[model samples]
Target: MAGSSLMKSRFESFICDANESVAIQLVCSDNELDNEPHNHAIKEFNPEFSHQLFGDNESIFGYSDLRVKLYYSSAKLNCFLSIGFTDKVTKDETNGIEADDVVDTIRQKLSLKLCSSMDEFRSLLSKESQFIPYGKLMDSFSIDWKTDEKQTKRHFEIYSADILVPGFDAYHQRMQTFLWWLIDAASYIDADDERWQYFVVYEKRSPNGLSNGHLHSDAHNTYCFVGYATVYRYYAYPQRIRPRISQFLVLPPFQKCGLGTRLLHTIYDFYVTDTAVFDITVEDPSDNFTRVRDFVDSKNCQKLNAFSVDKLKLGWNEDMATEAQTRLKINKRQARRVYEILRFRCTDRSNADEYKAFRLGVKQRLNAPNQKQILDYQKLEKLKKFPEQELAFIRQTTIPALEVRLDLLDKQYKELEEEYQHIVERLAES
Candidate 1:
């Protein structure tokens, strides 16, 4: 009974749709309250538009005259009341009503068909209870892609110029931090899962860390070649990719910049070249079809199929079977299981873990040789320094402050050393 008030409030909020002309009111009264005779009112609004726009019936170019009947429907209002509570108010004492009696009276009058059960009518209201339409869900989770460069730089900068493939220690630290952030955000949304997973996009970077050269200077410049080791393993063969991309959005300031596009292109190049992958499959939130389509088109890619789970069993073909087998070879049975889990069942921690394990396995495979080469190169490069570049960077950028602090510390150390020597000499004389 305590929750009845909250339910009533929620029901009242549901009636506030502008398209539907409906309103509900509730009143309360004491047992001794004198009540007036109840009367319900119904009103219907007339349609403003006429059927003449479609032309008269049996009229060819309005030449033939024919009679037509067009009845346009409009919004209608209705009121009803419930059966009176005889225990609370006697038939002779109808002049005075209790709060329960009033509610019962309203509910009875509201019932137009006495033969129909109230239980059946109550079932109709259940349809309106706490449901989100598919269209609304799609609209809320749409992804927006940008083609501009200046915009992308505002959000994510090139933190590292060279490969800087995160070491295992660093990767573990970053992965832990990333998991914490994911848990924190998911908790806010009351999501069921506490685990988070992502696929790492490994590719070559340009010397300057710019994917595309100066936007204005090079219209037909030779764009950098960013090859993918195994596109299918990195980008495709994952279930969460679609929902993740849909809900994962870049800020407005990051749009129109080449960052998103470049990142995608890098992945695309990897799939196309290194992996020889012709088709890259992406699952996008239903709302992000436009963004996904645009990205596909920009990369000269084509949509192979709009995948759904039921089709896997009922409509499995030779081509799909072969592809599934290939995926199994690369990723084992886990890949197929992930597809099945994501397609038929609700996304949960198990699916996330499966996806994460598959990804880590793929990355480990690719990085085996690449990781060794990177570590060896970094070790050798650390010994060499470009004095000119270092001086330029310190003078042109904010590094001068750091240099100034070093100079002050050097001066203070020298003065302290001199004072210590004088104190030592004084002690010797004494």
Candidate 2:
């Protein structure tokens, strides 16, 4: 039967019929039902659970009982739960398992755990297939970046310098949303001035067009660069700098293909060789950045400091700094190391230390008579260098009045203390 032409033809016909019928049913059912209900059910199955179980081949189906059967009838495959026990099963209706049968079994098993609509089931199956072996698929579909570098430049212009171009606002906004989805979190990508300055690589369509669909889109086409160093500058000097990058986004359909790597390499190459950007810094560790980090490392790009702007910003607050100092032991040596890594110069280390000590001392002396003197001295020193107009304004302000009252109170208390000291001395003499 396996070798017979008639049997082979019949089997082929059955497969074609089953595929067409099932495809039609799935499409029709998908349109009728909403996927949201099943999404919540699937969420119960931890998003990472599939990754753990399947290890890339996440598309799985299972059944509760082995009695469930799948059959291809009238060119369409259908699943049914066994109704009753039978003494003997007929040869024509033999209980056999196929690949599809296994899938059906897994689906049934999943359905028992969650209330999933037909649409949701279909959607899940489709998505499951997409992510399964995505890395392998990407590797298989890899494109040579060098082969396309010149072609890409000739066919599609690659910009090494930061150009002032229009219509980037829309692209940047779109890319922000796309990157957020890819990274699995909402992150702002600012294109402010300071950040824009460091963005070296950019791409736009030439008068002709790109050979690859990944390079240029018919609707919206722009490319931008993003690195850790660029982000750090923005965070550090938010008031002084604006962020900038190419607006080109790697769409969902285009991802997992080597296009992402190619684009990134193209940009990197442009920076290193074409643009002469010697020092390139990426925020994420090589392992975490995945392909981008790998490409950079392959290119012999050096890894700089592992600086986190959020940590530096946290160090700005006194309480937070104290807490961090206590928890992390951010002493003078650590502070100096951080400053050296960040390239910040401390001109007056002793003065800064003294100021810190003075502040702490003032806090300790809050109830003392000299508290007024300490406060007045600090305030007067701060105001002494002010311009004439500012000094006059300060004199007119309530600050001056408060200072005068505090000074008078301090002098009167001092006079009383002196008199008391004289009386003590006279008593001692007697």
Backbone clashes per model, in order?
Answer: 20, 18
TM-score of each: 0.21, 0.26
- Residues forming the 10-long window of minimal summed lDDT in candidate 2: 131-140
Provide the overall lDDT of each model, using Cα atoms, as 2-decimal numbers. Answer: 0.28, 0.31
- Whole-model alpha-carbon lDDT for candidate 2: 0.31
Question: Cα RMSD (Å) between model 2 and the true structure?
Answer: 25.1
Worst 10 residues of 1 by lDDT: 69-78
Highest-TM-score candidate = 2
lDDT string for model 1 (181-256, tens) is 1111211121223222222322111223323323323232112111111112233454322112212222222233
Candidate 2: which stretches are off by over 4 Å? 1-163, 197-249, 273-278, 285-288, 299-430
Cand. 1 Cα-lDDT = 0.28
Query: Residue 22 in model 2: shift from native, Å?
Result: 23
What's model 1's lDDT at 390? Answer: 64
- Please tell me which predicted candidate would have the highest lDDT against the true structure: 2
RMSD of each candidate relative to the true structure = 31.9, 25.1
